[model samples]
Target: MRCYVVGGAVRDRLLGLPVSDHDWVVVGATVDDMLSRGFRAVGKDFPVFLHPRTHEEYALARTERKTGHGYKGFAFHASPDVTLEEDLARRDLTINAIAEDEHGSLVDPYGGQRDIAARVFRHVSPAFAEDPVRILRLARFAARFSDFVVAPETMALMRQMVDAGEVDHLVAERVWQEISRGLMSERPSRMIEVLRECGALARLLPEVDALFGVPQPAKYHPEVDTGAHLGLVLDAAARRGESLPVRFAALVHDLGKGETPEHILPHHYGHEGRGVALAEAVCERLRVPAECREVGVMTTREHGIVHQAMELRPATMAKLFARCDVLRRPERFEQMLAACACDFYGRPGYDMRDYPQIERLRVGMRAYVGVDAGAIARVLEDKSKIPQAVAEARAAAVADALRAA
Candidate 1:
């Protein structure tokens, strides 16, 4: 049996990128052959094994045919007769289809090296259109390699797939999985743009897709619309090295703007309140994790108020903190502020602008936490009145802190 290193490791190395993992394609190897060499079978759907020593995955060279719909509807064939070329032919992208043998001899059956040099994302064959997940993966790859562009033919093929209702079959877990990874990339906006380019964004995330042409009341930069602003926010979140929750919050913080009435034009007076429910709907639809959903919802519900923190009354600010559960969960509050900062900096010519609101919120957080709620509660005999007294004390403490400043 001959083993060839294939997929991401080889592709990343060819592009002078740091290789994180090695995926081996074992040609002319059977399940028993791998087991005899101490490889543990790990893949549930196909013949994939883990090396006993390095623990890296070693999948047998195989070709698959689309049996039905979605990504999971496929039949696999793996045997000693499967050729390396056959396996590479079934891969999604030409760049990932390259293989390197044990002697380090490169095999370029699909012109992966040429495409890599051209900084292009090209599909390998007609089979590329079979899997719906490939579209998400391609978009994610665009986010990672910010300079690379998708080939026109490949883009057209993806559009065809979308038109054929292939992407509509994608499940929520898989959609979230790919999108969350793309959100963490260096240029997360590219993922959104790529998905939009081929119309997958409209099919998958109609809420976000509806935002593109909508106008916002605030135009910090020349960015045309709320959709352009969303792209900027996503990239800004990535630039700040934010966690997933913060990034997600930055993504959906403006959903309510999409639901604005045409007569109102740019002004979305109560978008934040409307956005809270819309954001929650998106979280529920995507089945996002609780942490991400909570942060997304909070940022959507309060980002407008957060931007106006310095102007808010101390009582109002205290109510904001208390409503956000700042005393109990301060980290979530911090993430909310960070997401708001992303929204603040996302516009053109706004990166240099000072966000004094964040500092004010931080000061308020410190003062809000400094209030001895336990002490105030113990002194108050009426338990029902304790909440009101504590809230008043907290607001007063914040007022004093702001006054001293």
Candidate 2:
């Protein structure tokens, strides 16, 4: 059996990127042949094995045919007769379809090297439409290869897939998986833009898609369009080198703006509280991780408070902190502040702008957290009274800190 290094390993290597993992496509190999050689059979839908020594995945060269709907509806055929070219033909992107033999001989049946050099994302064949997951994958690739342009034909095919209702069949887990990866990529805004272009954004995340035409106060948001502001926020998150939770929060922080009453025009007076439920719905719909979802919810609910920390009364700020459980989940609170900072600086002509409110919140939280609630409870015989005393003490501490600031 001839083994060829395939998929991401070869593609990344060609792009001068770090190859994280290597996958081998074993040509002229069957399940029985692999088992006889001590390769552990692990694939449920197709013939895939673990190498006896290296332990890397070794999937038999295979071709797939669409038999139904969704990404999992395809039937994969793998046998000793399956050719390397056949396997490559079934891949989603031409750039990922390239292979390298054991001797390091390049196999470019689908012009992957050419496309890579051209900085283009091109589909391999008509079979690309078989899997709905490809749409997400293409968008993710756009995020990773920030400079690469999607081929017009490939984008058209993606749009066709979306129109055919393939994107609607995407599972929540898959949708979250792709979105989270895209959020962490080099240029996450590109992923959202691509999905929006292909109509998958509306199907998977209507809450976010509805934000496109929504208006925002031009004075506060020089970008003017809430959707464009969201894009800017996502990119700002990337620029700040934020974690996934912070990035996710930045993405969902303005969901309530889309639900603003038309009569209110661009004010969005109560959008912070309005966004809390909408952000929760988005998190629930996408099955976002609990940690990320919590941060997103907190940011949506308290971003305005965070932005106005310096101006808020100590009691009000203390209530905000208590409501957010800041002392218990300080990291989440920090993430909330970071997301708000992204939102502040995401507008046109506002990059790297100073946000003194964050520092004030940090200092205030530091001082307030030092107040011992247990000690205060010992002084108050009534257990219910202890909460009020603790809150008052914390508020006093925050007031003093703010005054010192």
Per lDDT, the best of the predicted structures is 1
Cα lDDT of candidate 2 equals 0.91
lDDT at 104, model 2: 92
Candidate 1 Cα RMSD after full superposition onto the native fold (Å): 1.1
My TM-score estimates for the predictions, one after another, are 0.98, 0.97
Writing each residue's lDDT as its tens digit, candidate 1 over 1-405 gives 999999999999888889989999999889999999999999999999999999999999998988999999999999999999999999999899999988889998999999999999999998989999999999999999989999999999999999999999999999999999999999999999999999999999888999999986555547859999999999999999999999999999999988998899787788899898889988998899999999999999999999999899999999999889997899999999999999999999888989999999999889999999899989888899998998899999999999887
- The window of 10 residues in a row where model 2 has the poorest summed lDDT is 350-359
Output the lDDT of residue 396, model 2: 98
Q: What C-alpha lDDT, on a 0 to 100 scale, does residue 10 get in candidate 1?
A: 94
Residue 98 alpha-carbon offset, candidate 2, angstroms: 0.4
lDDT comparing candidate 1 with the true structure: 0.93
299-348 in candidate 2: lDDT tens per residue? 99889878887689999988888988888899888889999999998999
Stretches > 4 Å off in candidate 2 = none
Model 2 reaches what TM-score against the true structure? 0.97
